[model samples]
Target: MAEISGVVERIWRYPVKSTGGERLDTVEVDGRGLAGDRLYAVRDGSGRLGSGKNTRRFRRMDGLLRLGSRLGPRLGAPQLLDPLGSPVEDADAFLRAYLEREDVALAREDAVPHFDQLPVSVLTTATLDWVRAAVPAAVVDERRFRPNILLRTPAGTPPFVEDTWFGREGRVRGGVRLAFVRSSERCAMTGLAQPGLPHAPEILRAITLAHDGRLDALATVARPGRLRVGDAMALA
Candidate 1:
């Protein structure tokens, strides 16, 4: 059994699902999912997969949208809000919603808005270093790829620690099972300049160039029930 050692440095949860979220030292997790992670979303009215695709056209929109957890947890039911913690929902009773509009177009039938299909996205410091070395042009940072788990290695290590397993369950120190998957590709969303964070190759350009124009390699937690800082990960 191979291993990738690291400690949880930070945690982030998107209360509104797709919209941005707040950072926390620690939080609670259950079967439904992370307590505050991706609780709401801006749906496209059809009750299907949604995001800021069209909303990005609006100047006041874009990353301006955010999720707030002040209203307490609603289980799988997420409420809407501005970048700030406020209250919002589907006026039309749809899955997706607009940043500024109360009632927007929604998917015709019943579906749901959510983060990427995976339950949790994990990034490691070692991998970031590899990216920096491969593509010096890209100020490779975590913000570009919003990962739920940020694993910090022992300062110097190889790249893609999670790759130890092509496709298998990794037993994190805390005994959590993370079914490693193929690397996650980059997109325009990565290029979006963060609010206060410095700029970087949010586009998958750096990742692509580094991996032969292939934006692959990202770790995800499968049964994220017992993940915590200081959890050492190993291929199961």
Candidate 2:
């Protein structure tokens, strides 16, 4: 008893996580990810990714805490630099400093590093509500989702609905088209204990258990564009 509904709400990017977010008025669409989202990351000698699924192994790596603010979508094209604006001639040396350990160099100039999977990430209000109701303890904010796009769909729709979005594009007013991909898989990161949140996993577990063992979110464009707020999402 449901029908296709346009995006009731959407989020275009993140300014700082574990802190606050910068809601966009409109954004461009790209393949790699939102026009300019998480272009740079802070990885130390301890090469590991913080994917909202696991964290026990996170100790090996450090300093990534700063990436949330240091990265730019392009960082002036390629050559990803730190927040301080230094040329990372040796990304290893640049990142290893935080580990206070040694360099592993898991990053790539041609790929997205320190990120869980794709450059863009997404989630839904419905799905988030489900998680909150189940755990009733953790702080399940968009930071946990780390998504560039946060969708609010028609009521009663399934959670992690991105899987159904393949071959479809979320349009904005009439300027850009942000497409959707398959569902994201869940991992131990989602179960991790955010320094202040005790019941974080109980919340994530709700989604994992509800939707088989996968995490649900959305992905968008990689190129930058001029997207206006109040755009309409139309599946193509």
Candidate 3:
């Protein structure tokens, strides 16, 4: 019998890669992952994808995190929001100005989502707490890791429990099934300065040195369905 492992504490979807994302009370899961997650990305003049993981491009694309993206009423259409949280009518101009690169343009993902590695990433609060204990100075926000699902593990569970979940099948609310693939690799973007968050290099260092540069677990959809906050996750 499957046992309760954790409860979904949060759901996040990034319409644009390397930028701010939207938090939802409920979301749909598919083979591609959350419906609007990573549907759009900023493509540079050289045709390289603008991602915080790509340090060279990301350095030039500073303040990318200040821009927020949300899906419009229409599917695959995203609305850009400025740092002040105001809708930007001319998204191209606004993004170019924000990134300080005239050659950069917002592009939509084609057949596949613009994911760095896996389609979905999951993290547990116990792991976050352990990281906070390791690096008390850094702000250990879930946004830094960019996880799609943040699960609240039972109190006192050992840190990095998700590591054990690798290769297992997780059922969400007895509907959605996810196959845990591997642990997510950390990147330089975790140290980048974002809105209300200061740049803290130690955050990445702590994960690298102690956790082998991995924290969250990556997964792919096994059975597409609905996911909501407070949904219980069971593993088989």
Q: What total of clashing residue pairs does each candidate reach?
A: 22, 20, 0
Instruction: Estimate, for each residue in 57-144, the C-alpha lDDT of model 3 and write its tens digit.
Output: 3434667887788986455578888987888898889888877789888888876558888999999999988988999988878988
Q: In model 1, where do residues sit more than 4 Å from their true spots?
A: 2-4, 31-33, 48-61, 64-102, 105-113, 132-140, 198-203, 212-224
What would the per-residue lDDT of candidate 2 be over residues 1-236, giving only the tens digit for each residue?
22344463666564322212346756655555554454433333454442232364333232332332333444342342454444456655755664454644433333433345555665777676777776676677655655566666777876556677665655555455555666677654455443333335565567667777665544556234555544445666
What is candidate 3's local distance difference test score?
0.86
lDDT of 1 at 130: 74
Candidate 1: C-alpha lDDT = 0.55
lDDT of each: 0.55, 0.51, 0.86
Candidate 2 structure, TM-score to reference: 0.65
Give the per-residue lDDT of model 1 (tens digit) for 1-236: 56556778877676654455667665555544556566544444344334534433221235433333322544445444544345655524322343445444322213432545555677778876776676576556675567777778787666775566548766665556666676665555665665444455434576666654333234455665566666676656
Give, for candidate 3, the lowest lDDT window spanning 10 residues. 52-61
**Candidate with the greatest TM-score versus the true structure:** 3
Q: After superposition, how far is residue 176 of candidate 2 from its true place, in Å?
A: 2.4
**Decreasing TM-score order of the candidates:** 3, 1, 2
lDDT leader: 3
TM-score of 3: 0.94
Q: Candidate 2: list runs displaced more than 4 Å.
A: 1-4, 8-23, 43-67, 70-98, 102-108, 111-116, 193-199, 217-225
Structural similarity to truth (TM-score) of each candidate: 0.69, 0.65, 0.94
